[model samples]
Target: MGYFRCMLRNRVSLYLVLAGGSRGNGDGDEATTPALALGGEGGIVADLISCLEAVLEEKSGELAFPGLRQVFMLNNKDAIVRRAVRSDLAMFLLSGWARAREERMDRYIKSYLDVSWTPVMSRLAAVAAKPATVTVLRRRRDPLATFNSVLENACSAQRCWKVPRPVLRHVLRRTVSEHVMPAYRRCVEEVEQPAAVRTER
Candidate 1:
């Protein structure tokens, strides 16, 4: 039974990659078009969702295959595939699969945010903390510039834009609480502190 389940998981993962047009090797390359000819078709989308649901419903008491989930979560390079997967996942959640897997879904969203936003936030934080050169000072002086730039780029990303409205709202709420608020607080403290004190620290 264990071996059978493992084989089932491997098969499902392969199907997910092909159905979602994700690259097989997990490089950051653009996702190839699914040769299954399942681009944005409702049937293929439903099948993908059903497969994911079955995996989530397993009695193992843990997510069966995280790599497969990551593939589904991050496969946004192709427009048709992105739309189909995004819409289908959203519908699956809305249709009540999320009730039992709420924590799992939250984890997925957090992982997505970590992947998509963490680097941008880290870079901005580094720029903010640097010696107050002309360029860095300009950015720090008007933090809105930094924030808006990040927001614009995030909104433009395929992964961010493809997220469903409800899921996006949840993501924004978490982002505000977990990242933006803390960062904004630090920025304010830094701006208000005397340069001598900051330098001393």
Candidate 2:
């Protein structure tokens, strides 16, 4: 998990490098967030894929669902954690898109993109919660199934929706459950998934 997390950050850095090229710095100026800017050509996406290639070259381990992950983001996650999380998250996002395209689910599609509460996330949530009529016609998606269909992958189109800034700031926390965030809070501070200390049982 830690390595994957670092790789994500490093991948972003590598993307930055590619986007800007090796440039000279001013004596005391700060580097601006080039990736944060939207509506550009989205070159970081290419850099991100390049970073994933670099990471795979460095780390050699087998995973159950590399193919499915290529469809999502690269594997910046534990299989267990990711599979669990995906059960809910990916189903909603992907299925919604499919329904919108096929059955002309225009309203849900708009809500999915133009959400006000949590912005895009809320939109995705709404799309996920749509009645079966929306999804029953499209296709059967297990949502948790590991996909091995090797198609070309890119972070554009379906994967490139940006969260509106105001709504994003208001609901920036990843999960609503407070206990979900810091499992590392320690030593008399409570933690939900703390490492078990050995005791003479």
Candidate 3:
């Protein structure tokens, strides 16, 4: 039991990269957070997958569920421990991965809406500030490039997240449609509009 627990703890430590590193608790000293020290979002996610795979490989034979509907005799403490180890390890990994993904996605969304969108929106505001001729062909912001860059970042993050196949697909589809699509549409409209019409609004 102790050995199993130790293995579980080691696996989790590798998963989070919280062990074997200088760490900060986010208080104030300017030390790097564990996630950041581990090499940012992508690295943490990759480590998570690697650790999970390693644990599964190490415990495969012992982790098989041998019963139909689920039958575990309470009197058998060994059986209970085996069941707990398998189930608990899975739960811990999945919950931790989900949390990491959630935080990463939130950060990406905030960047998209705030920092990434700023340049184009600022240009739009500039146009709106002053009237101009429709055919002047003055230098204008290219939101398409910005939108594409943001989309690429989101896609890369999703690929590295490695949660589960179905969950990853759902997250990517929903995030792209909800966040990137609207910005894309707005960019298209702005680009197609004549200069005078753009600035007028």
Best by lDDT: 1
Poorest 10 consecutive residues by lDDT, candidate 3:
67-76
Q: Give the poorly placed runs of model 2, Cα more than 4 Å off.
A: 1-13, 19-27, 34-43, 46-201
> For candidate 3, lDDT tens digit of each residue in 1-201?
343456556766654554345445556554343333555443443354445444543553363332200111111222323343354344333335445544544554444345434443555444333334323433554434544554565455435333234553465357546754565566556666777666576
Q: Which scores better on TM-score, 1 or 2?
A: 1
lDDT of each: 0.49, 0.32, 0.44
Models 1 onward score TM values of 0.42, 0.17, 0.32
The true-versus-predicted C-alpha distance at residue 133 of model 3, in Å, is: 10
lDDT of 2 by residue, 68-169 (tens): 222122222123234323432221122233332223223322332232223323323333343332334235653212111111121123344333344332
Ordered from best to worst TM-score, the candidate numbers read 1, 3, 2
Q: Report the poorest 10 consecutive residues by lDDT, candidate 1.
A: 73-82
Q: Which runs of model 1 end up more than 4 angstroms from their true locations?
A: 1-100, 131-136, 139-147, 158-168
Clashes of each: 0, 0, 0
Residues 1-201 of candidate 1 have per-residue lDDT tens digits of 232334335655645655565445466665333433443433343455546545544532352332234324422212222343344233222243334344555565667567666756775576467634424465547644676677667556534343444554565467646875677667656655566776686
Every model: Cα RMSD to truth: 16.7, 22.1, 17.0
Candidate 3 global lDDT: 0.44
